[model samples]
Target: MKNDAKTRDELIGEISRLSHLIEDRLVPDNGMTDDQLRSELGLLRDLAEQLSESETAKVLEKPAPSGRVESYQRIFANSPISFSENDMSKLQTFFTGIRHSGISDFRWYFEHHPEAVAKCAILVKRIYVNQATLQLYGAGGIEDFTDGLMSIFHEESYRVFREELIALAEGATSFEKETVVFTLQGERKDIYLKIMVVPGCEETLSRVLVFVVDITDRKDAESMLEEMRKMLIRTSSKSIDGNNSKREG
Candidate 1:
C-alpha cells in the first residue's frame, strides 16, 4: 500500500514537471493571460521548496545572469536613427545624468511624428538655436523640445524653403489641413502631411503633432487623376452647352 502511494506521488510530480517544461519552451508574449502561468510558477516554487536538501542546493546554487542591460545597449547601437559623429556629443550630454529613459523603446520614434520633422523642406535641428536642443531631440521629454517650435522653425523654413515659414511661425498660420505639397519633395512626388494642432495643448512648448506620409507614386497618380477629372468636367459642361443651343434652335 505504501509503495502504491509513493508511485501515485511520483506520477503527479512527473505531470507537473512536464507542464513546466512545456511552458519554458513557450515564447513569452502578451498574447495569453499571465494568471495561469503565474499559478503554475507558484506551484513550481512550492515544489522546489519541498525538494530534499540535496536537490534544493542544486537549484539554489545556480546563478542568474547579468546580460539584460548589455543586450539593451546592443539594440540601441543598431537602431535605424544613426547617431552621427557630430550628433553623438549633443546626444551624450542629453543622456547624461539621466537614469530613467524610454530610449530603448522603439515605438516612441514612430509615435512622435518624426517623419514630419524628417520631411521639412528646411530641417530645424534644435542644436541650431538652443544648444540644449541637441539632447532633447529624440528624448521622451516634450517641453523643451516643443517650446517655441514655430519661432524656432520660422527662420530656417524661410531661409531654406520659403516665406510660408514666417506665417507658420507666427500665430496667424493654421496647419490643420492636409497639404499635398508638404508631402512631395524633389523629382519624387511623394510628400504628404497631415498637420493638426492639438487643442488645449497649444503652448509654445507643446507640439502641434504633424504626421507625414510619403506617397510619391500616389501623388503623381493624383496629379494625373486631377487632369482626368478636369477633362471629364469640361467635356460634360460642353455637352450640356451644345444641347442647350440645339434646343434653342
Candidate 2:
C-alpha cells in the first residue's frame, strides 16, 4: 500500500511538470509547431492513463483544495487553445439503456440506425466555454456563442460527431479529428479537435474537455504547395512534348 501511494504521487508530480512545460512553450514567438504540441499532449495522455488506474483512483478520491481549483480555472480561461467543458451524462445513460436492451454490437447498430447516432449527439450539452473558445467563434461572450452555435458548425462536423459517439460506445476515452467550422460571420476555418472524457468523470461523462486548434493557415499552405507541384508537372510535360515535335520536324 505504501508503494502504491508513492507511485501515485510520482505520477501526479510528473503530470504537473509536463503541464507546466507545455504552458511555457505556448509563449509568443516560441515557434511551437503543431507536431510539438501533439508530442507534449501525447505524454500528458499517457500520464492521464496511468492516473486512471484503480489504485490511483483510490488515492485521488478526495476533492482538490479551493485554491488549486481556482488555479486550474485560470489556466483554462487564458490558454491560447480553445477549450470547452461538456456534459455527456445523458448520452452515457442512453448507452446504458441500449445495452440493457441487448444491443451488444454498438458499431453495427449505429451504422444501421443513423438517426440513433444523431440523437446521441444531441444528448451532449455544452456546460462551459472558455475565453479562447468565445473568441474562436467570434462571439462577444458565452451567451452570444451559445445562441449562434448552430450557425458555426459546418455540415461535416455532424459526421465527425458520429465518429465520436461510435468511439465512446467502443470504450474509447478520447477522440481526435481534423474538421471544418464556420464563424458567426460565415468565414470557414479548418481546425484540429481533440475530446477527452475527464479521467474520473468517465463513468458519468459529466465533464469532457474539448480542445480546438485552428489549422486553417497550415492547411492553406499545403494546398498552395500541391497546386504549385501540379503546375510544374504540367509545364515539364509540355516542354517534353515540344522537344519531341521539334525532333520529328
Best by lDDT: 2
For residue 106, what is the lDDT in candidate 1? Answer: 27
Best by TM-score: 2
Please write out the lDDT profile of model 2 over residues 1-249, one tens digit for every residue. Answer: 346445534544544444344434333355744455345434333433443553323323432342343333455677656877778888889889889999988778777887786566557677778887878888776666443235576668767777887788777878889898888878898887877776677788777767787767646644633554465556668779889999999
lDDT (0-100) at residue 160 of candidate 1? 29
**Worst 10-residue lDDT window, candidate 2:** 54-63
**lDDT (10s digit) by residue, model 1, range 1-249:** 245335434544544444343334432352433344344334333332333233322322331132232232233233321121111122223222121443533233323634433334323233211222222233333343433233223322323222223233333223322233321111222332333233333233132323233334433433533554465556668779889999999
Candidate 2, 245: how far from true, in Å? 2.0
Clashes of each: 6, 0
